[model samples]
Every structure is written in structure tokens, then in C-alpha cells.
Target: MGKDAKRSELGQFLKARRAGLTPADVGLPTDGTHRRVPGLRREEVAQLASMSVQYYTRVEQGRLQASAPVLATLADVLHLDDDQRTYLLELAGKQTPRRPRARAQQVNPQTQRLLDALDAPAIVLGRRMDILAWNPLAAALLTDFSQLTEKQRNYARLVFSDSEMKRRYAGWERVAADCVAFLRMEAARRPGDPRLRELVGELSIEDPHFRQWWAAHDVAAQTVGTKKLLHPLVGELTLDWETFASTTDPDQQLVVWTAAPGTASEENLAFLASWVTTHSPGEADDADARADPHAGRGTPPAS
Candidate 1:
């Protein structure tokens, strides 16, 4: 058997999922019921899963281990999707398997070369959405990674901690939610990752939206997406991004962005690159230039 995950984590995941649903959501008749809590009661969940209230309660309390079938039934009753169900099982330390070891934010030279060869903006992300590395075009397209400290160089921090990010994206909520969802997925995958936990804890305490969104237990493994940026210099830019996982190292991801040919977005990118080359300080490829230090963006308090 794999290393046992914290029973409390399983309990929290189940409670979060349960809180996101109501009687009406599961086709149960609602007769103007006044409930203290926001979602289905423990008894309701037990009834839906055909389990004893005591057993379900014990499972939720992390006092008892949830067998595979019990976990599956609970997942079904909770209406967990593929990614969420996987996360559920991982949290329970049931059928799901985990990587032998967690990885750090180190990229391959060949991968870096490939990233540099791309004309479009690109970033290499770690398991927790950390900005492991980024190319010149990426720096030009987004905030310069070098300008940020390690803790600030994260999607969640950038999306919630920085006001600039809100003005940067056209659909800030959707994108920020996606970022939160992705972090949730990683949380289950790396339940014991200290850095990942610190990232979540920091966001949870500092950002109210992050705290609420995290409690919803949403999970996402989006490989491709679109981001409409209201770029300050070049105006609006519509870019499509693709994430490629390394064949050699699953911990690292290569995310590349591109705009459709003949679109103004593409022209904007070209002009942006030229501006970066001509006006920006330091080497285009070097992770050096600019300064944007902000408070409360440091690493999570030492655990």
C-alpha cells in the first residue's frame, strides 16, 4: 500500500464536496426547508450513499478508514467529476496511486532550448503552478519573472495578490477560478508537499476570495485555454495557451501561447517582442530586468 494520506485531508475533501450540493441539486424534494448549514446534511449524504449515519459521520471525522467501495459510493453521491473523483480517492489514500517522490522546479536544458526556440510567449510551470522558468517572449507578454521573488512568481499569487493581474485579464474571475481549481488538483496529488501547502495556506489567509473558492473543492486539469489580456502597452491581446508535460519529468510543464495568424493579437505579440528587444534592459533570454516587490508575497511562514 502507498503511504497513508492524512485522514483529516480526506475528511475535509468530503465535507467541501458535500457543502457544494443541496437537496434540490440531487432531485430531493425541497419544501421550503430551513437548514443551518449551506448544503446537504450528514444524514442526507448517508441516505444517498446507502450507508449508516454513524459510519458516514465517522468517515467524515477521519475516525475510520473509507474502503474503496465506500469511497466510490460517497464520490458518486457527492457528484464528483473525473478530476475531482481522482482527487477524492487520492485524499482517501484508496485506489489512487501517487508518484514515489515530489519534485522541485528544475527544467531540462533541452526543454529550455525548445522553450527559447518558440516565437510565442511561454512559461515552464512546476507541480504547484510555480514559475519554474520562462522565455523572453513570455516575459514580454506577461510580467517579468525575474522581477518577482520565488513566492510571488506563482499564478495564484499573481491572480489574487497582485491588483495588476485583475486589470491584465479580460475574464479575471474565470481565470482565477481556474488557477484555484488547478491548485486544488495539485493539493490532492501532493498532499504532503510543504511548498504546495504553504502556497495554499498563504492564499487562504491573505485573500478572502481564495479562502472561499478553496473551500468549494473545485479541481481542474486544463491542458489548453484562452486568455484575453488588456495589455498596457499594445492594447488588447487574445492568446491561446497549450501546456505540454515533459516525457522525462512529469513535474515540469511547458506552457506556450500563440495568437491566430493575421489577427491583431499576433501583430501585437510581434511588436511586443521588438519592444522588449529594443527597450528592455539586460538580455532578452536572461531572467533579469525590472523590479516589482510587494508585501505579503513572501514564502509561507516556516512550518
Candidate 2:
């Protein structure tokens, strides 16, 4: 959608969510008298958010563009949870889609070499979260994306559409939200990429949860975090994760996973790494390699 349309939609969403809250919910006094509006007064919101009443009114009217920090402050004052916070930011045009520069025709050989050298699981992801390249260790640590067809290599798509993702990650909800947030940020960065639009369309149709999450319009920058993986062969693993921007392809990112030293989860990750190397395909150069290898291998991709 165009920025204006998106802003209007976001504004409506914020108003609806805000109106649903009662003053007492946030520990404010409610007179219990007849009311024209359901929520706190605009002045009350402006005071709490450290904004002027006129400016807050302009924002609610969709006539002002708010800065990121200001929107964040307003979200906090509004008692917005993650989803609501995202919605507020989007409404203020803080998360508009971006126009990406043209992509290179070929992946860099040096990048491939770097992936091959990592003992920790690491994959090179396109701006839209496509699994552009991964090493054997990376394949072992997570799902074997290198074995998938070109069309099936997207991480965001897999999380939303593939059932296996739910089973593979114990903290699927948080992971899913973060994935959505990342994609939202990417959308702002590369708004013109047709592939990104297609991925969003596909996910919106295939998954109800994705449809709900997409409405929030959240965006997140890459940072170190933790993830829990339930490997079919090796049990559970809690891994520390980091993401780095590719120097050659700044739009793409390298996501790496490592477990804490001397932990049982680290040991489990070690076992799973060995398991993926032997079973997952080293590359996707043929139809046979791209075919669904998970057939009868495990439960239907999460559920």
C-alpha cells in the first residue's frame, strides 16, 4: 500500500485499540459517568506522552508525521504491548516501505567461503529473509534450507507457512513475532522488490496467524538474541544468535547461531551439526535435491 493509505489504516487501528482500553486498566481514575469516548482524554495522553495536546491531536488525525523516538514514547504512554506499539509506529509513517537498489546478478564466492568456514550455524539471508546460502553446519543447526527449491528458501515464508517451524522452535510465538518484525523492517527498506510482495501475499493467504501479525506493522533491527531449537535427532538446544550486514551486499545479512560454552544445549547442537552434514544436501543444483526430502522423515513440518 502507499504510505498515505498505510498511515490512514494505522491511525484507525491505533484509535480502535486505544478506545478499547478503560482508564482503570492503566490505574487511572474513571468517574463511571456517561462518556462520549471510551478511553482517556487526548490531553491526558499528550501529558503522559510528554507531547502537546494539539500535536497529539494532529497525530491522531493523521495530519502529522512522528519521529521514531516520539512514537515509541507515545506507545509506552498508551500502554501498547509489542503489537500495539508497532501499530502506532506504522500509523505515524515511522515504518513506511523502502525502495531497494538493484541486486547483483551473482552471489559472491567470498561470502560462500565465509559460510563454509563457520563452525557455528550461519546462513546468508537476502533482504527479504531468503536463504541465499548456508554451510553444512548451518544446515545441521537449523532446517536444511539448501535442500529446498529456490521458491522454498525464504525463512519468513517457512515460519509462517511451513508447519515444521512450530515444532522445531519451542519459543515459536516470540520467534514468529520477531520474524514478522524483521520483515516489516525489510519492507521499509525494499518496498519495490516484487519478491517481497509475493512472499507477503503468499503468507497472508496460507497462514491466519501471519495475517493477524502483518497488521501490526512492526520493524526490528538485527541484534544478538537467543533461540530454542528442537532438533529431531538431538533434542533441545538454546543458542545465542547474531546478525551481520554483508559488505558486498549490504541489503543481505549473515545470521549466525552459537551456544554457550560448556552447556548441555551446546552439546546437543554439536550432535545435530554432525547429523545435518550427513543427511542434508550440500547444494540445490537439481530437481532431486530440491524435492521434499522430509517425506516420511519426520512429522509434517510443525503443524
Candidate 3:
């Protein structure tokens, strides 16, 4: 989609939200009058929001531009959630999704060190959820990102296009839907990003679910969450993941996945690390070796 489509996005988002609510839902008295359209009418929204019906109609029709404050008011009136409100305001030009500097291609050395120090799966993601880097544990738990092309090392790409990814997740459709929502949030944050545009276009063409989910206009930000994976090697792992943003790079974030201390999941993680050490040799060793300077190096020369 282009600039015109941006207007369409804003309009559709508003209409979708409105359609999701009813007169009773918003505490409006039903006059027993038959409704022409679903949800609250434009007049009711305008009245409750303290705006003119004509203005609200124009805004919904994507004909007139409204101020950020005005859009914020509408967001409140619509009872938008935090993510939804942010997405709505972003679409209304209250924020710039475009980066002032170049989109990040690499993570800082300190960040990489942090990943190396972790005992669990860790990954650094750059703009458009590209797999910028990952710890060996992550490589073991997830696919070996090192073996993939740059274009192929994307979260959305893998979740949608890779057959193994579908089987990896216990509930593939929910995970895939969330991936689409995350991409939508990123796309809103950086409108008309060519690379982002290309990613969406490709997924829309090749994947059936991608097209529908993308069209849903849902937006989501990564947060503390739990993921259940059926690992081919170690079996089931229910990992908890948390996402932390980089202060230097807004588009860069670190995601760490760990299992509870004494659960079977944690034991499986240990087994996975061992499997990596055995198969890849040095890429993933025991927990202490993860902190060692030469964790995976060969035995030292005899003195």
C-alpha cells in the first residue's frame, strides 16, 4: 500500500473498531429503532466525542485531516487499547515510524556479549524483525539462522513460509497471527519502508494466512510472553520470553527465552545445549562454558 492506502488504513481501522462496539456496549440507550448499520452510528460517536457528525463522517471517509489531539480524543472514545491507541495515533501522524538514521543491520558488541553470557536462548532483532544475531542456545532451539540468507533470516518470513516453523509451534495459527500483528505495528512505525513493503508483498503473495492477517489491521508490540515449542531433538519446551528495546536504536530489541528453573522445560533446554555441544562442537557447551572466553575451543596444549 502507498500514501493513499495509509488514509484507507486509518479509515478502516476506525470503522473496524466502531463495528466491534454496539449501542449497549457503549451505554447508549437503545430507542428500539431499527439500525441501518452495525454498531454506533456516526452521529452517536460524534455526539459522545463532542465533535460534529459531518466532521466524524469525513474523518471516517478519509476525506479530511484531523489533529493528533483530535485523533487521541477519538481513540479514547473508541476505548482503544494501549497498542491500538499508539497505532491509531501513529497512523494519524502523531508519531513518525520512519527512522531518522539508517535501519540497524548489526547489534552493538556489548549486546552480543550479553547474548553470549546468557544460558538460555537469546536473539537480537533489527528493523522489520530481521534476525541480526543470536546466541548458540537460540540457534539450537530455533532454526540455525547462521545457515540462512539475510532475506530469509526474518521472523515473519520463517513463521509464514517455513514448513518446519509451523510444526515447531504447538499452536501455529495463533503464533503466526501474532507475527503478522507485530509486522503491522512495525509497518505503521515506518510507513512506506521499501524493505518492509517488499516483505509484506512477498508474504501476501506466497502465504494464504499472511494476506488475511495483514488485512486485519491488527497491531502488536513484543512483550513478556510464553511460547510452547515442539523441538525435534529435545521434545516439548515451554519457554518464557521477554523483549527489551535498545536505547540507542529504537528498531533494535533483544529477546531472551528461558524456562522455569526446575521444570522439565529447563531440563530440555540443558539437553538442547548439550546436543549443540556434541553436534556443532564449541558452539554450545555446558552452562559454565557459555561464560568461558574459549568455551568451545579444543583442549589446551600440554605444558
lDDT of each: 0.74, 0.68, 0.76
TM-score pick, better of 2 and 3: 3
- The reply for model 2, stretches above 4 Å from the true place, is 1-101, 276-303
lDDT tens per residue, model 2, 1-303: 787876677667657756754453233444558878877677777876778999988777777777888877766555555555656665565773332446543458998898898888888888678888888877655566755798898888777766666766887888988888888787666543456656775776576666667766667887789988765555567889999987777777888999999998787666655555545533211212323432212221211
Tens digits of per-residue lDDT for model 3 on 1-303? Answer: 566677778989999988866554333556668888997788988987899999999898888878987887787567565567778777776773433445347888999999988888899988888999898888867777877899999998999888766767888888999998898888667543557767876887698677777767778999888999876656678899999999978778999998999998888788777666556522332222223322223332221
Every model's TM-score: 0.62, 0.59, 0.61
lDDT head-to-head 2 vs 3, winner:
3
Off by over 4 Å in 3: 1-104, 281-303
Ranking by lDDT: 3, 1, 2
Which 10 successive residues of model 1 have the least lDDT summed?
Answer: 288-297
lDDT of 2 at 179: 89
lDDT of 1 by residue, 1-303 (tens): 233446887888889978977664443445565889878899999998998999999999888998888887787677665577777777676676533454355888988898888888888988789888888878766777788898789877898887766766888888988998998798667544556656776776687677667777788995999999866566678899999988988877889999999998888778767766655413322221122122111222111
lDDT for position 62 in model 1 = 82
Predictions: Cα RMSD each = 10.5, 11.1, 11.7
Q: Is candidate 1 or candidate 2 better by TM-score?
A: 1
